[model samples]
Target: MIIADNETAIDYLYYETVAKTVVKLIRQKSKEPLTIGLHGDWGAGKSSTLLMIESAFKGQTDTLCVRFNGWLFEGYDDAKSVLIETIVAALLKERSGIAKVADKAWDVLKAVNWMKAARTAGSLAFTMATGIPGPDLIQGIGSIASKVISDPKAYLTGDVFNKVMDGAAEHFKEAAPSETTPQRMHAFREDFEELLERAKVDRLIVLIDDLDRCLPQTAIATLEAIRLFLFVPNAAFVIAADEGMIEYAVRNHFPDLPAATGPTSYARNYLEKLIQVPFRMPSLGASETLVYLTLLLYLASGVSDSSVEFKSLLEVARKALQRPWLGTGFDRDKIKARLGSIPSDLDAALQLAAEITPILTEGAHGNPRQIKRFVNTMALRVEIASERGFQDDIKQSVLAKLMLAERFAPELFNAIARDASADGSKTISILERKVTSKGGKDADDDPMADWPNIEWVKRWAAITPPLNGIDLRPYVFVSRDRRTSAGIGVAGGPVEAMIERLATSTLGITQVTKAEAAALTPEDANRVFQGLVTKIDQTEDLGKRPPAAEGLARLCGDRPELREPLVAFLGRLPVSKIGGWVVSGWGVAVEGPQAQEFAELVGEWATQTSNKPLSVVASLQLNPKSKRK
Candidate 1:
């Protein structure tokens, strides 16, 4: 699917067109050194993008591009040291073309044994190394290396070049400052101009990319250096950037930029002086993106079944594209009108299919881990159904499987089980004692403490049309200590209530089955209670229960008899299974039926609800345990 074209080298993809635009712009402006800054997120193709650009212009234009790591030069102590090294290296590579012209120039400077005040040794080497007329670079390089070895250091650092230039300033009848580094600079600049002039015999362009990858301060300074100080008129600068990222960096470094300097607008105005008109990348339209994703899904999956189709697949893309970037919004009606026509039988399956698209596609939402998980999950079920030959039922099974997995996430069942532990028993009892006086408004302690556990609890809550679980928080009883000579009663009773809470919560954690109490693995049962205790402190909404369930389940481990008693105790009344758990038609607590009496109550609380039976189901699940069904 990746067809890289312009600066589109294999390692560096895309931006072929942009790179061409950049090259053409700089070539017409000047035939000297050009600086280009490529911008994007750290790995958003900035460095590699320019490398491809560099590759394209290599032979035709006397061009050079380097991906300098800002961090690499951090040890140099200051920006100047790094800048000098980098630019010198760049110039040397540029001037030291096929022939080695800088050879003689370097030999003259080195023989003088000069201390570098301005001219860089590397730049001098390039000028002296590249312009020779010989076919081989090394032949000329060796010729120069032989002459300059004795005083190589002086070629860049010394007083010789400046002394000669200054000595000639008046003789040439020039009036520029003769304090002489600039005169020496004029010497090198003239040398470079001549070298490039001869090498290309036409034009040259230098493109520098990935300045955006630099740390905030470094990027600003690097950009400032080239733009303001080293503004080579002949070398056109082609810089790419996200305007916001650069401005934010400036604001971070100088608070005054934001506070006093009209920081919000300053950087934008600053960039105006430098940035040549940008070649903007166009955004993909929703309908176009939809078609792109559809084709990608069909290609990746190989087969699209009735269980997964294009329309619903788009919605799945919605969930996968949850990140703010990429603009993954769904115009439901428009999408339906467009894709809604794709073979009616495939609608449900295609939507299911689309759900897996973002999982497969690479973009903001396309984290490989998320992609693998979605495929593993949905593909497993799809394969199973295909083998069984239940072609028609595949869509339902896939949805059921997804919903089943949802039940297990920290968000739902797991979270409820962890929070509904005994550690908060004393706290709840204390709240009760304090709240009884006004009967004052109940102080909301940790919301986690009283949240209902059990799959039934969740099922009831999600029920549409005023089911038994509709906001049934009030009737939920917090078992308190019975009054005694010790004032509010025996603290021992609270622990017993905690036990009852565990037994009830356990029914959800591990489904109760018939078994004998004696044969039950006592330790397994005990750890279930213990595990709940351990998890309460660390529990968040996506709560994790300790390794207590399996151990507790083993209490009856292969012993059916022992589990039977507890199972019967749990089975006092049947709780209708809503989705995963069985619940009685009562409001949010115990399992029971109260259709006639609760009718008015359901109607008064929620008049529009058509399904009254389910309303009472929620109410009962939240109620304390009624007799076993």
Candidate 2:
């Protein structure tokens, strides 16, 4: 059920080299207490690493596997009594030499168990199931008598008083040793050694699993107890943990106490060294990720092993990922159709898929959990596509429509911004208005035409759309200027333009590329723009203005019906012999100008410029209730 484990006769997917190294780390330890540490980013495979290594050392004569599951025990082992219980319990579970004297150990364990109950009960009365005490001063005595009535292990052969007193003294001493501080000492080892001596053994191997999942100090104390107390003459311990998480947890939990006391860092390191055969784990390779991903897709789609359908999905994934918007092995269509069918409430599923793919493929920058979320969202979109028959009938609830549009526009705008800023290039100007989904009106700014660089503006206008279109139908491309020798301002201030005059340029572009178009690279796109520059500069004359600069006299080359409102038209400049808008007006008289007509037209123009933008406007007539100065 928990796939966190690697190889345990389950559906164990193989990862490379991690398991073997961990085994080697465990197998090669010296007399010092060994603590093998396995670590990984959460869900990146630490648990699996632990289980694989655990399985590897299962029955080896020198190997003892103890899985210290965090959930089973609740208290911090530093509590004098808790540590004793943990060590004794862990040692018993193992096939240690101490196990041979199981009867004696069991008797000792039962006595220690009573320590908790007797401490809870009042001095004279030992609490029982009936909450009754004996007539005289019987603590554990009367209780033991009642419970051990027939069993010899519980029965007393000698003076039950003397035997009980000796056993009581030994039990307290073993639980809280006198030699070292109660919390820091290793008397549990002394007890274990005594038991092992009775059983006749030398070395013991124990596994501590899921220790990393506990509070760091508790986990550390358990390890410390295992290291110093519950051991034979030669003892080995292999602990399972997320090594980094464990270190962080331990450091955060204990702070200076563990480090300043002795070599806490060194002790931690020492423990780590014991895990000599620790199976190190790395992320699955791309091929392996794909294999698992395919398997996962097949399962999520509920399409059982029908080779025909599986193959069809694979084909869809392959083809869909080739689009510029969707990276390879990442088809948005496949994601929506075959993953989680995205719960319908998440209307931004398509856009989320587009954004997530980069993260998913980013070098184990993502894990299986993230992978699942992505698949789920994609699957949702697929369900929509299926229900709608890939047509328009799939009712996009208002929230969903708004979600799709808002999510799409800003991301697209950001993508454009990033593209413009990429490779240390500053984007001085962007001609399009970034249209997010809140309004019908779009951007009122387009400064590319007025920039001083005429030829650069020429090529930009030629290649880019005339104006920002809301249909999302335009093909975006990046064209690099490939010309090694072109004029300075040909393609917007050429490299080394101050002293240079000409630049050789090249341009190539194919518009109408689908959403799934081949990638548009900066170099290639720049080159295409450069070609357009070459064409425009080759034909246009910068030497002498064409009689009346055509662009100045009219709206522009394509749409010449409207006039440029930015230009000021004046009747006369008395000082100069010019028949154009004048900077100074002396003796500049037009006798038939209409005042009321001019006032209304001027008011309309002013109002419209502020409220509704026109691409081009001719002349202003008048603002009513106004007169010529």
Candidate 3:
């Protein structure tokens, strides 16, 4: 069973404590206008924490809590107006029994409508009031309004402008004429304060989530809306977002700000000024990750999250999380002791969690969402193997071990797959011996001597139930079509488009393609590189240089940070299987300090006794003029 990836009010991961602390802070400062920044990375349970805080304020008559997701209103033309209208509408709905509260809400909506019309009509209304052209009349209006006023012919038509003005007149029928934007803002705030007083609400707590998912413009607009209530009494806002994304939005919204202003960046300064109290969500450690995974597996095995049994297990897990340094989690004895008896499925779950926790903790970087995703993926693979009638052959422990390599060390995983596919025996004797060997760390005499000297390889080999003589073809076949652990799927986008073009472009990558490759973010570039490597791994013949080979070389040339991974991939390739073309095709990608490493690799290839063809080719490259001069 797959775990749903949505936010819940459950106290998993011990986030309820953080939520309770935030709720207490809001209650203590309910009368004053307050803004608390609930900061975390994506999928770090920020939304779940928000739900917990809202749950804490349940059934409280004096304090009213409203939830607003900026991402939901991202498509609207004006986020600022949408946020204001949402709060007012919520207030009116809750206080419908009060006399004239609906009327006051209608007045606030009319004011919001006026603000909307003014944005469209631009400085025409303000220009008429001041009787001047240029920036002087556009002082109080925002930059967008000023642009419309500065050049009305470009942004506004005569008929559209008149319609906007007519709408404004209809909205403000009972109000005064020649009312400037600043005056309208002041009136809107005063009216909102009055509505809060009439509603008799002691505190208005607005919880905003998913601000990081919005575009730069929407994010900034929502922040601007929050600014309106900064001075109004009895209003508190809890905004949840990734601080880095918000800072990026700030930089995009104000591109002219200096990179370094005083001690911090200008973008950070803007966020600091808006969000008064900031709470950063901590990433899960190994022990906490173990507890989380164990609970999830229990849920997958039909243990209801709301049941008393689950709650008791949750308490045990939370206590274990408190002293994570002890490295103790929900072991088999603990589960049996609490539940009085362990289900057959839960026994398997405990074993899988114990086996996968070490690497998964480091691989997922202690993110709960990532850990859940890994567990879901493993469960799905196990189901697939069972569906294909090989359930007995593909044990959960063995599959978990293989998936750890697939998720963390992809290059090594690919090599193992290649070896399994090349020989019908479905076994790599060298790797089998490496994992089964019990000795000190000596790379010089290890069967995995050619593999990279990364700690992950050592840790993976040290895992229980080593693959000494298991027929891995079934496991490899089941996991063949899975996505890379980078979370990038086969979705069509700019990066995927580039990858497709580079993979099949027989004429070679063009200058436009090089520029495009150079423009990719480092993370996207790595994804593209990984995609290319996957393509190379699937190819039947390593003797010929596929178009993806050229693409890899060019990408490495564009992004030098990829050279090390490139070298590692080359080192893992079967020397006898690959062609001599691998000897020297990276024109400028291997230069500077990397050139020496390339030379050493070539020297090893030249002396290799396995493949004479590769050795001869590498030798020729080392001394090309020996035969001519």
Residue 610 in candidate 2 has what lDDT?
28
Q: What TM-score does model 1 achieve against the real structure? A: 0.38
Once fitted onto the true fold, the runs of candidate 3 whose alpha carbons sit more than 4 angstroms away are: 123-167, 171-178, 423-432, 435-453, 483-629
TM-score of candidate 2 to 2 decimals: 0.40
**Looking at model 2, how many pairs of residues clash?**
55
Candidate 2 residues lying further than 4 Å off, grouped into runs, are 1-13, 24-33, 56-64, 75-100, 107-170, 173-187, 193-205, 229-234, 257-280, 303-358, 363-366, 372-629
Rank list by TM-score: 3, 2, 1
Location of the lowest summed lDDT over 10 successive residues in candidate 3:
123-132
How many pairs of residues collide in each model? 83, 55, 0
lDDT tens digits, residue span 446-505, model 2: 433332344423233222223332221111111112222221223333322210121211
Candidate number with the higher TM-score (1 or 3):
3
- Residues 514-582, model 1: lDDT tens digits: 343233356644443443333321122222322322323433343333343322222221122211122
RMSD of 2: 28.1
**Candidate 3 residues 189-219, lDDT tens each?**
8988888988988999999999988998899
